[model samples]
Target: MTTPLLGCDFSSAPTRRKPIVLALGTADRGRVRLERLEKLESLAAFAAWLAEPRPWVGGFDFPFGLPRELVEHLGWPTQWRECMRHYAGLTRPQIRETFAAYCDARPPGGKFAHRRFDKLAGSSPSMKWVNPPVAYMLHAGVPLLLEAGVHLPGLHAGDPARVALEAYPGLLARECIAQRSYKADDKARQTPERLIARKDILHALEQGSTRLGLRLKLTHAQHEALVHDASGDSLDAVLCLMQAAWAAQHGAPSYGLPADLDPLEGWIVSA
Candidate 1:
């Protein structure tokens, strides 16, 4: 049987206007087909979705763990689950204050402590609290994945059938578009150029031209929907879906993760 795959574009705080988007699909051979898109307007909804009993391998666009240097420096727990649990107990303001202090102690151009995988993936430091607020994303999302009993490879052991891998869409996006901004959260900045960039990305995926070597099979309407959604939430979800497909193709235990992947600082799939 072809295992179902999910690519999630997450939000720490989701509402009707900017909900979490999940691209649902499956992979066979080297082809990934877009089965549908699901939106959750709240974390509770997302949690419920995760709790569903099914077999799936998901590529999640959120940091699954923090940098070991930052964690150790902060005197936090070193074990992956213990560290995350300790992190989950803190308020957002407390997290912000603590992380801010850590940054303040560092010199210019070297503020944020990063996971080793961050350098390879070109991802924002998981400790970042502003701009993208990926720190909060790790706090809000990872605990839910843990509570949902999903397996997070190279991090914590859980259900084998329901696997989750850390994923960054920008890694794939940069390969196709090379630093072109293809998305804008602010409606005023959603330019025609960005739309064209999105089109180009979709074209590249459909042709199986990206380094992951997976073809994206999207319906005409799905292609149009992804291109027109200026926020790029749907497109990001699809990007993650393709990554999940790639991971699934590898099959079983590691699911394309590096043998040396840090248990406390989970690696991104295909990074």
Candidate 2:
């Protein structure tokens, strides 16, 4: 019996315009055969998926916590689980007001507090609300994972068979195409060029040419489906799926993290 790998592209508020995307598959030796991709309509739906009986290892694209500096400055709990509990309790307005106050006190360049993994992986600051709104992603997503009894490897212990790791698809995508714009949420912006880049990315994965050393096997229909979604949600989910595959292949003896991982700020796998 092979273990399943799941990758998720999350949204704080999912609608028909943009929904939470999931990529599901299993690793066969060196190849990851993509079985299906699904778009969940609501947080309730996403939560139901998490609570399902099938044991899965998933790479979820969301910040697991705020930066250590930010947490310390605000006098929030230093413990990871404790911090999340505190965070999940606060209302959205309370959160925005608190973060806004913190940013206002700092200088322009150094205003945003960043996790160590943000520096290493070049991810958006977990506190940023405007650009990617990953702050909301964490608020919306992580608490559900906690409620579902999913184990977050180094951060939280739960059902060992139901593992969840923080993943940033951009980390893998950038390796294949150095910051080249490959996706846009707007229908008008989905150009031929971005489609070609997606093709290149798909090809690279199929050829077993990534640092993770795993290839992607997809049926003709699946290949078309991955490319047809110009929004890149599907592709992002697959990138995360591959990252989960790497962690599965490696297991979590190290929890697929650096030895010096901060308990206050969880590390992003393959960052």
Candidate 3:
């Protein structure tokens, strides 16, 4: 039997308004099926979920580490574990102030430092604590993975059955629709145009048209749920879920990450 795969749309401060979304499924022969999509109502709930020992791979939508440039500039530890330890100890305000100072010292268009993987994956700078607040996401999420002793491929090898990968739904979403918005957290901002974009993305995934060569098999209810979720959390979870499926298909030595990946700055899966 194939072990399950999961995709998480994480939030630093999860509440009923912006809960973490989890897509649970199984993959077979390049096809992935959706079993359920679970919404974790709080960060505590998310931590509890990871405590269960399970055989599964998950693509978590959060940066696993800071850029090497940022780490070195701060004179933090160069090792991944030590760097994470130092980073996790800081308050959010301290992080913001430090990052802002770092950015302010740099020239325009290069204010924020980047990891090699961020450029390849077309992801936002991991240090940005606002907008997406991914810095806080890392602050909130990475510790949980570390505590659970989950395998992080190149970064920190642990349980093979419970692999954790950095994933960005935007990388895969751009495969179908470039520069088009698909989700909005605010109910009023969920527009019809974005709804159409979501459908287009779903159609592409179902047809196995992307580079991954995997088709998504969703039940009628599942399809409707993905479409009706104007926040795009469900679809984003599905995208990460497919990434996990693709990684599993290859028996990914580095979980579909490049061989030359930086252990300090973790790579995004299938980027």
- In terms of lDDT, which candidate is strongest? 1
User: What is the per-residue lDDT of model 2 for residues 1-271, given as tens digits with 9 covering 90 to 100?
Assistant: 8899999999999997799999999998999989999999899999999998788889999999889999999899999999999999988888889999999999989999999879778799999887898888899999999999998878888899899999998888888877787899988899999998898888988998889899999999989988888999999999999999998988866557887988778888988
Each candidate's number of clashing pairs is 0, 1, 0
Better of 1 and 2 by TM-score: 1
lDDT tens readout by residue for model 1, 1-271: 9999999999999999999999999888899999999999999999999999999999999999999999999999999999999999999999999999999999999999999978789899999998899999999999999999999888889999999999999999998999999999999999999999999999999999999999999899999999999999999999999999999988788999999988999899999
Q: For candidate 1, give the lDDT.
A: 0.95
The count of backbone overlaps in candidate 2 is: 1
Candidates arranged by TM-score, highest first: 1, 3, 2
Q: What is the RMSD of candidate 1?
A: 0.6
| lDDT of each residue in 189-208, candidate 3, tens digit only | 99999999999999999999
Mark the regions of model 3 whose C-alpha exceeds 4 Å error after superposition: none
